[model samples]
Target: MIRRPVLLRAARPVALTLLVLFGTGTGTIDLWAQPVQKPLTKQAQTELDTIGAELRANARKREQKHQSARQIAEEMERLRTQMIDIARTQGASEKRAAIYRSRLETLTLLEADMTRRLGTLRNKQSRLLSALQIYSRNPPPTIFVSTRKANDAVIAAIILKEITPELKKRAAVLSEQNRDLIRVRREAALQNEALFISESDVSEQQKQLETLMADRAALEDQLLREADAIEARNLELEARQRTLLGLPSPLRAPQGRALDLQLPVVGEKAGSYGESIDGQTNRGLRLKTAPGAQVRSPGNGRVEYAGPLEGYGQVVILDVGGDYRIVMTGLGRVYVDPNRTVAKGEPLGRTPNLTDKPTIFYMELRKGENPVNPASGFDLTKL
Candidate 1:
């Protein structure tokens, strides 16, 4: 367990409830993306500069030190809290997209489940009808049989009388299940309609959001300091990685004991840092993100390398501070140039569009030359 970290110490318990009630038909909510470009107030600009300076300083630190887990968690939590404050409401576009994508996914899964249940009900009904068919095909022997068999006929009649109520009960159950089949069909159709609408909305919104993000990035660029030297080093690392087909060593820095990214993309929980999945041990935290989802930097850092490599798609490596680096993979686009200093919540790129599965964002943290549990940097033991 980790000691109380900064963000967790200040955070309160939150309870979330998810309700999936289906309607007979689809519904629509008119939505629009009109990001107004506002000039940063003087105070905002000052805050940005402060954050940038901290990132730059962290990137240059060369001190080497060892600390207990508590010390590391505390330090990482402090930086995480700062970068989160930098995020603000600047992610309006991506935030909307995530909401829609989540809705579409929920509907898709719900339809699949309903379809499975409907099939099971149909099969059960067929088996039950077959079992009752013999009774249905013949009536009990008439009571007007020969004298020797008259008693047997009477007994059979009595038995049928006793079982009549049970048969009716079974009939009622079958009727309800038929209604259920109908309802499931209606819900499935509703979901399909909703899914189509949501997909279209997402595609349109992605285009507009990309444009909005570019404008914001352009404005912020003019206010930030230039990093020519850092860029040069990144280019060299990029070259080496291509030649050797391996990750480059961390450029000297993170004087701080703990490290973490707030999480670049908002996505569904995939796995923890050390969990074993399939047959391999997971080395990083992975999040399942939707196609065209925007990925932002989780904390203050410098882009050590950005772009595609052989096995990995478009990737970004950030040198946060003191022998520390953050590597992200499975991105479709990389917007930031390598070696550029970025504050928390800056858009890094977009995930590729895929048909079979949602994009899985893979993130890992390294200290010097070894991979470590990324969760160790967070102070989440409290709440």
Candidate 2:
């Protein structure tokens, strides 16, 4: 007997608990407020700004990497189809061989570049880890002695000690940077491997056509299927790697209900549920955010739909679990694809920066086909 896949079940008690915990007298939850940070010195503030910039850059890079990989896979599929057509008609011409060789060379160059980048990222990671380990073992030396006996050397030492915390903070930031770099590198390497395999298959097909005089239609169909299978395998492998790196995996069993979900983007509330817009009642919460603000996933889920809709500019529909889905719309660009699993806090896209108009994001939570108030299940009052 074949065992059927288990469907996710809802934890109604947890959902009710969330409703009680986040409900305000006004019947809405605010998720944008964050704890105030202590004032920092000018230098410390500058360092923090630098770190923030680096993190944003890393996020951009990771998104770009995924986009590039997707493009390459699509190109490979297109080329495979073209090869099939050519095999059916021209029967392995010199031009076909040349095209195959050219593509292989391009893939080789891309693999080399990714290898170099990975090496550099790993080196930086090693250095940062070593520094963090040393700092952990040897705490900053104390310089304060008796105030009466303090001299110029003592004062200098005290000043150095004061800088120790900042140094440690920098090290910690570097460590996080390394982790991001490493993730991107791993993704790049996977793409390179996929490309390499595609090139190898093309080369093998070419050789068979030249020497073995294989049946054109039969060989083409077999290779095309193999290419499709390889692409699917690559996607599965990449998904697994992402899961190992702490991101969500669609294949993994749901652990528990995600009752307390955060807002996908940080912004001021613009519209509320039950509000009328264009003769229709609004079924979700809306926010006005700065142009080009990054939008993130509010909960761990597989992307069921990620593309432009008739009314919404760009939309991402995530199936959280137990028939619960989250819909986010009004994006300028989408970073993820349909069927990809996304973790909570993972970047999904960016809001458009329109100079003349405010960038508005619309979000909704649903159980099956029925729309529900997002606040009913999520505590969005605090980050």
Candidate 3:
């Protein structure tokens, strides 16, 4: 009898801790005091089986799309190589050269369109990957629910009666999250595969275009006799080549001082340069702000990098001319793509929504990979 009272006293603290964690009332203590087992009914089993089948089917569909994208990318690469080879061998025939040029022009446009599509897929994949990581770190408890009311009654008597309502709610939320994670994982895998294939396709096309340009330059020197005519034709070809290749003009320094530039995002500085986070010294300033807050470009520049980065959810690196580069990270979504130009104050991306944690945006200025204080260039009062 004395031992019984001692055990009850010891169990009280444990029960109370659980109640605090789960936010359950005193009435829930008795229900959750003992372990219980309940077998799922036939209808409930059938429903879960159906759900599993649907998930598999969706994964297969995504796989098919991935394969299709890969095939198309391969075909694009082959066509580009064929066009370049034809242009080099048949340059003497004006009709053949014209045909090859037209095909090349079409291919260039198609490549750009495909690149944009791939970028979208990459962004989606990044978001899904972030969610997956979060779920993996803090997994929810599992609880089985029955679909048939009669079976549910039996299950409830055996198990549900022994589980707190708060815990049941948590279990349900976790179950839904698991389903979402499965779907997102399959989709992200397909997107990544498609992106890899498209990148290879674009690289090959660019190489072929460069080769064709070189061939044209050589042929011009061999065929043309008049120096003046040859120079003029070469200049025209050079201009056409630059346009077709989408090469940027020579980099020039900005007119105003760097300090006059606007702030990238509207937020208070959380950490300054030289401050250590997780034992690593910060090379830039961390800005704390609301979730989904818009991140903007501090000055006119081109996007150099935009995608998922380790430790950072999504990152965007912008080239602002004169060897100056801006690095922004901890974004939820990116609005720009590499090689795309942006004006000052243009939207670059948004900070991720971390419900239980504060959203922080990290920004750094660099001159050839050497970190510099961004505050030296921006108005401190505004940020």
Predicted model with the maximum TM-score? 2
Among the numbered candidates, top lDDT falls to: 2
Off by over 4 Å in 2: 1-258
Question: Which portions of model 3 miss their true places by more than 4 Å?
Answer: 1-259, 354-357
**Local distance difference test values of all predictions, in order:** 0.55, 0.59, 0.57
Off by over 4 Å in 1: 1-257, 354-357, 378-383
TM-score of 2: 0.35
Clashes of 3: 1
Residue clash pairs of candidate 2: 30-380, 30-381, 31-380
State which candidate, 1 or 2, has the greater TM-score: 2
Residue-level error in angstroms, candidate 2, position 306: 0.7
Per-model C-alpha RMSD: 27.2, 38.0, 45.4
In model 1, the clashing pairs are 253-321, 253-322, 253-323, 254-321, 254-322
- Per-candidate TM-scores read 0.33, 0.35, 0.33
lDDT of 1 by residue, 1-383 (tens): 11111122112112100001121122220000111133344554454344334433433431111112223324334444544543443265346556655765775676577667657766875675565576557655656567757776567568767866876776687577667657656765665566566555545555555555555444323212122233334335334322232223433343343764566775665877788989788888777865545678878989999989889989899888878888899886688998899998887876653222466888888887677877655322211
Give the Å shift of residue 354 in candidate 2: 3.9
